[model samples]
Target: MELDEFDLALIEQLRVDGRASFESLGTRVGLSRTAARARVQRFFDSGVLRVAAMVHPEFEGIHAFGHVSITVHGRASAQVAASVAQLPDTPFVSVVSGRHSVVAELRSPDVAHLSDTVSLIRSLDGVQSVDTLILTHLLKEPHIPAHGPGRPEQFDETDRRLLNLLHEDGRMPYADLADGVGLSRGATRTRVLRLLGTGVVSVTGMVNPTALGMTQMSGFQLHLETDGTTALSVIGRLEQVSFLARTLGRCDAIGTLITRARTETVDLLDRMRAIDGVRDVQSWTHLELVKEQYDRRPLRANGAAHGAAASR
Candidate 1:
């Protein structure tokens, strides 16, 4: 998407606090609430935004995966990409134009699932080679750092507080949240609607993997012949997978997932590896996740916006 100053501004606003209201956003951007809503809707309809809830695997149950760099043997990278993406354990695929080009995230129930995912990869149509590694600790999953080169502007205190409330529970009602956060319900409702409309703070239905009967936690990195981040959605629907993303650097894509299938082991792995582009992998058995965040919002340090919106 062609990102202009206004689009960048919108993104910055969301980065500060995903749950900012339409009225609140309008106030910040010098537009009316209706205009702000229209602008956000346009961006969304144009495929310029993506908002998802990413959960920690170990936080919910027993799940694991392997990460590897794979090198696809032929130009049919897309076919291979599609094949690997079809695996139940894989929730994301990236076809890149470098060494170890096809990076993928594989989900599994246990070590067996890990082995199976590998076997599946080895058996794919265009796959030439596969390497495997297990994850020890997740230093960081996917995160947006505030101190990055082009990080968003410093959020005022009010933005921070508003974010804090939503991170606690994205689904919290505006009326109830208004009382908790010291805001009028109408204003709170407007603010939250803006947040959602702007591709921020996506309130979604989430289920604990363990609670759902999955019994393991893990991760993987894949290497492939071709590279790109267009296959994330295709991979996200994998049976037990939860989160899938097209990363900027490092691995082409990644997925955090859960599972409980036994016999679908080696065959699955072979099929994945054998796919056109996959060549290698490394798996990390997630022992624990120190921190997990889905854009926890933070108002401006001075709470200026929150107070202003509330008073209005």
Candidate 2:
């Protein structure tokens, strides 16, 4: 779909505050509430945008977080990726062109869960090998800064209920949320704002790159000749980059890039190689995205917890 200036502006504002009221959003984008609501509903109906809550796995009792690279023995890489995507602990899965046939982001509640996931992947038919890159620290994630205030010791039942409601719909109205969480409107507003300000949660809009005319999603694993900070300083500035992380593994750093055309991907790679400190770069163009979920945590009816079996 072609997005005009107004649509773009609305999207930008929603990215900052997904739960912004239609009246407030309309005011910001120079439209009436009815008009803005229509545009947003259209975007949603067409699957162009989604507003949802996302939490850092670490704060949610997740004991492990990392990327898993899988190699397939034959032409069954796509099938293997599909199988891995069904695993509950994995939230991101893609078939790509590179040394590894498939790559997925994994979140586990503990070491045992992580081990089970690894074993399951290894036992899959046509699987050749698996390599994991554990994330020691996050330099940047989504639009939020990685370094933030410390996490609270624990969440009460009310907080969990609020989080569950937001998980289902980040744009849920305060009155509805207050009803769901058994809080007054003012209290609900304050609690939600505090959760966002403290980095306990994030509510934002996510759009598929293909929906925006950027069809190619690729991964770049960088072996840097210079310090990671220097390399990231150069790469992180690029607008096409969606995810970036410094790692402790075979590659010094890795990142995902989105581009509109094959030529653009080539040009991007060339520019990346030209960076003074970038020693080598391997590009993996995604062939198929088996699964991608911004919010991996599962919500419970009682709001007792998050984390459930993986969904296909």
Candidate 3:
């Protein structure tokens, strides 16, 4: 569905605070409570918006995460991309136009598990080679919850069940959640509030860029001439930058940007180069998004390879 100014404003408000009361949201976006609720419900029903909990990997005991770029043989890019996208460990996958035909984001509990999953991707038919950039730190993630200082040491299996259910549907009512997890509604609400207060997971509305008319998306790898402190601060403020991370790889950092047109991308690249301490920047435009959901099941069941054979 096409999003007008009011719809976009409502969505933006939801992004900031998904659990905001309908009355509060209506006041923020110049709509009545009933109108705001109707707009949001319509978006959810039409699949234009999703409000879900995005967990912070480090807070969840996830240690290995990286970006894997795969090059494929002639006429095999689509098939290979589909195969890679199906793997449980690869949460985000997209076909792009550049040296690499497909790129996938890998997340695992440890390096060994990540290596096995990468090896499985390499073994896919028509796949040629894969290059990986191990992420060191997430410098800026507007969508994810801010990484809190402590991991929830008291986290248990019941917590996992609650988190998994929230990851699927963040707005699930306390009554339904309690029924699903066999807890009293009051207890379920208490635990959920704790999770949110601790920054373990954030339930926010994730907008589909295409529906908002910002269709062009690109990924960039940057080489830094310095420690990247200044670069990170400057780049993080740009509205176009949705995700940014420091990495241990050929490039010092990588980021994903969404723009309205190809020319805007070129303009953004020029701006990035002008930032002090940025030595070089390379980018690739996304051709198609094969998979974009954050699949937490793999990390939730740590040490289970899911058919990916161990690789040294």
lDDT of each: 0.52, 0.79, 0.81
Q: Local error of candidate 2 at 271, Å?
A: 1.1
Model 1: ten consecutive residues of lowest lDDT: 303-312
Model 2 regions more than 4 Å off: 110-116, 143-149, 299-312
Over 1-312, each residue of candidate 3 has an lDDT whose tens digit, in order, gives: 877888889888888777777888899989999998899999988877878677666655567888999999965787888899778677788999999999998888799989999899988998889999899888877545885714556565667678778866778878988998899999998988887888777888888777776899999999998798898789989999988999998899999999999999899999999999999999998998888756344234431223431110
TM-score, one value per model: 0.44, 0.90, 0.88
Candidate 3, which segments miss by more than 4 Å at Cα?
2-5, 298-312
Per-residue lDDT for 290 in model 2? 88
Error of 2 at 47 (Å): 1.2
**Ranked candidates (lDDT, high to low):** 3, 2, 1
Query: Could you tell me the TM-score of candidate 2?
Result: 0.90
lDDT of 3: 0.81
